[model samples]
Target: MKKVLLVFCLIAISTLGYSQISGGIKGGVNFANVDADGDPDGKTGYHVGAFLTVGAAGIFIQPELLYSFKGAEDFDLTYIEVPILLKKNFAKVLNVHLGPQFGFLTKAEADFGGGSQDIKDELKGMDLSAVVGAGLNLPGGLSAGLRYVLGLSDIADNDALPETKNRTFQIYVGYKLFGN
Candidate 1:
């Protein structure tokens, strides 16, 4: 994990030169849920973040830092997630993104006033996922997109409970402040 993160960082930093750099903020709605033994229901949440887009032409690099809310009806989780995506531009108005994401769990608790509990131990410290999305690349960097995040790691600590993973569908709008 460390090596992968380091390599990604190096690549992102190296690509900043001789490329277009655009920074922007985005906010979106999350249709999130967990696939686990309990069959917990899906939940609606929100995520807001900022991103730096590097590169130009047919290929681009977009690295984002987002505050994400996720999980199922029984529990809610908050995470600080970083997604580093490689994008390919098609024509002038279409773009597709594929990437890996790293997430750190910041908050976890039962919902519906189930009361507070130290449930961090029951969850994974770090979450890993793969993201795939498509966007409409409009002029002036204004854009709207949809993404699907598939969790690659199991979060449940107990062996009795079925393996749990995250499944999220996100809709967001973005605008570029500068650069292409």
Candidate 2:
């Protein structure tokens, strides 16, 4: 995890030296679910973040910092997530995005009819995921997109529990802050 973060940072820093930079804030709705034994029900949550894009000529590297709420029914988890994406633009109105997302678990809770209990210690501290999406870049800096996040790492830390992974579908809107 540390090595991955270091590499991402180095790439971002190097790209900044020569690439054209643009960025914006975004927020969205998340449909989150867990892939595990018994098949938990999906939960609706939210995410808000900022993104920075560096590159030119229709290709770009975009790095995003986001606070995301994700979990299944009766369970809630909060994560600070960083996604480094390769974005390709087409026709000035359409784009495709693919990326690796790194998530750090910040909070976890489970409800068992009686009340909510903190279950943070039972989960892994870091999560790795892949993201794929498409977007429409509208006129005047506005944009809308959809993304699917597929977890690549097991989140359950307990040996006795079934392996658990996260899956999320996101719908979001954004407006470019500057640059081109």
Off by over 4 Å in 1: 1-18
Alpha carbon deviation, residue 96, candidate 2 (Å): 0.4
Candidate 2: stretches off by over 4 Å: 1-18
lDDT of 1 by residue, 126-145 (tens): 89999999999887779899
Tens digits of lDDT, candidate 2, 85-130: 9999999999999999999999999999999999999999999999
Worst 10 residues of 2 by lDDT: 12-21
lDDT value for model 1: 0.88
Q: List the residue pairs that clash in candidate 2.
A: none
Residue 63 CA displacement from its true place in model 1, Å: 0.8
